[model samples]
Target: MTARWKDLCLDADDPAALGAFWAAVIGLEVDPDASPSTPGPVSLVGPTDGHRVWVNPTTTPRRVKHRLHLDVDAGSVAEVEALGARVVLPAEESGFGWTVMADPEGGEFCVFVRDEPPAYRLHGVVVDCRDPFAQAAWWGRVLGVEPVHHADEGYATLEGAGPDDRLTLDFVPVPEAKVTPNRVHWDLVGDRDELVLLGATHRWDTPGWTVLADPEGNEFCVFAA
Candidate 1:
């Protein structure tokens, strides 16, 4: 059986602060039921179960550019900056429709301005890889979704994967190889053995979940069904 998208997880130095930043920017709320007595992830909830986001605590500092990042739709770039996001590449200078930005902790994300904010601000998840088509295809197989390839743009997208079909998984070509562990990753519910046969290599495991790297070396966690 193929894996199903579970939720998004982010490594942060301060889970509480980062969780608050994302909750405010994305119109989500900090999960009130999240355990406060233990050093655990800070959970953020949206209108749907598929819209959950976890800000997990980590001690390792980010050393390289993020291979995976989030894309958001906002009223304006200034709106996001007001929430502690810093602009890295302005849309006008990049000749792109979106502006590149960094979170308060320096993780990169893209912002697309809209006249009116949509019901959901989290637009998509993007991965930088050497071969966009292959990377997208591999994830499509694992996640049981079809990838729509954009040959002219050198990118591929997997739609219908998250809340209200508003979230997309995008793969775009990049020159650089992944050298450090990704600060952002997604989780899935599936069988570990089946995934291993699908070309995923086991990375490590904990009592709760096992970490596996995809064909392109992006790390993701798998929880048994």
Candidate 2:
């Protein structure tokens, strides 16, 4: 019993504003049903389904680097900065061909500038872990996807789950352990009991879904399919 990828969720102090910033950066439209004046969750949608991003209300401010972040394709760095994003590290410093940027609320996401941007801007969901291989393997089992290990680069990837072909779930190596709940997380539709059997720790339950943390303590929600 594998979980299917549902939506990416972000905890934000100002859901409307943060949602707007992400929509502008990723070329997604703010959900028409969302009320701008309300202090609730705001959702951003692409032209198709399965790539929705939800900006959820949270009183806690970010205190450290995000454990889970997004990597997006953009036309240029300047264009994204114009949307109120700050460049934490330029491409020159990254060694990789991407620029590290932070949203209005200080959530870090990488931007890869291309001469011509792809039809889909959201590139991948990246998780920083102490063991990329093990984390990737565990998530691969939960999602029922094959994990591609890049030992040289110290990363692993799970491709071809969501609607967009360009989107991937990437696990990269990091030195520090997770100290707090991740501000960003993904949701899935699957069997909650099966998830627990597969080593997920039941975190808590809400009215709609049950929250479970992976072996590394990264939280994700599972809903009945």
lDDT of each: 0.90, 0.90
Tell me the lDDT of model 2 at 113: 92
For each candidate, give its TM-score against the true structure.
0.96, 0.96
TM-score attained by model 2: 0.96
Q: List runs of model 1 lying over 4 Å from the truth.
A: 35-39
lDDT of 1 by residue, 1-225 (tens): 289888899999988888889998788989979835467789999887778999999989999989999999999999899999999999999999999999999999999999998867998999999999998888899877899989899999999866658789999999999998899999988999999999999999999899999998999999998
- In model 1, the clashing pairs are none
Error of 2 at 16 (Å): 0.4
Worst 10 residues of 2 by lDDT: 29-38
